[model samples]
Target: MEHKNTPIYNAHSYHTKVPPQGIAPCILHYTDPGDLILDPFCGSGMTGVAALMCAHPPAEALHLVHDARLGPRYAILNDLSPAATHIT
Candidate 1:
């Protein structure tokens, strides 16, 4: 069965939710096997997952930045806070 093309913003399936389904063909078009793709923001880890699904090894570098006030203000508080630790 063929998967229907849906807007990336609206779909909830893993293929749609994680990676913009429309971009799969684009990825295949531009990238060869094992190429490294980078998504700096990496919100929800979608791009990495998308690269893996396309038979790429997944993006090699990921930098996650969380808001500071949401968690910790100093070294000690950061170490103790789960949100801060997640950032680390």
Candidate 2:
């Protein structure tokens, strides 16, 4: 679940970042294809990344996903910090 070394996690420096890999499983579990996800405190847009990842999950992640909805979910990300929003 830790993604400190992943490319997406390393792509930016955000204090509140939650790795997309860690978030993806939950997204895949709770939502179906074409669902809309809203992240009010999005940092570096990791949740958005996770939502997209659900569409074409890697082979390694297939085992973790419980649902059969293997399609893209839309995301709306927001952050109070201008820098965070820009990065997202």
Candidate 3:
């Protein structure tokens, strides 16, 4: 699938959510398919969005997927802020 400069992950409000464009390259460079990407302070889950774009650019939303060789790639989105977690 082709990757867009930014995915459709900013449909909600977030005070400090990292821009999808900003973090996507880092995710692509450091991670692989079926890997678990963790964001302890994931304000609004841009990291998961980035990771998902890295592994599967066409995905419409965050979800677990089965890979034939690597099993499943997961996005562990977490935050101490209830608002942030809920937003994520």
| Model 3 Cα lDDT, one tens digit per residue, 1-88 | 2323344544776766556645655555556667888789988787877665665443323223333222234689888989888876
**Selected candidate, larger lDDT, 2 vs 3:** 2
The CA lDDT of each predicted structure is 0.37, 0.84, 0.61
- lDDT tens string, model 1, 1-88? 2224534333433332344333444444555565666554444343443455454222321111121111111111123434333532
Over 4 Å off in model 2, which ranges? none
Best by lDDT: 2
TM-score of predicted model 1?
Answer: 0.39
What is the number of backbone collisions in each predicted candidate, taken in the order shown?
Answer: 0, 0, 0
- Candidate 2 lands at a TM-score of 0.88
Query: Which residue pairs come into collision in candidate 2?
Result: none
Stretches > 4 Å off in candidate 1: 1-20, 56-88
Best-to-worst ranking by TM-score: 2, 3, 1
What's the CA RMSD for each of the models?
A: 15.2, 1.5, 7.1
Estimate candidate 3's alpha-carbon lDDT, on a 0 to 1 scale: 0.61
lDDT of 2 at 4: 79
Q: Compared with the true structure, what per-residue lDDT tens digits does model 2 show for residues 20-64?
A: 877887888889989999999897899999899988976556778
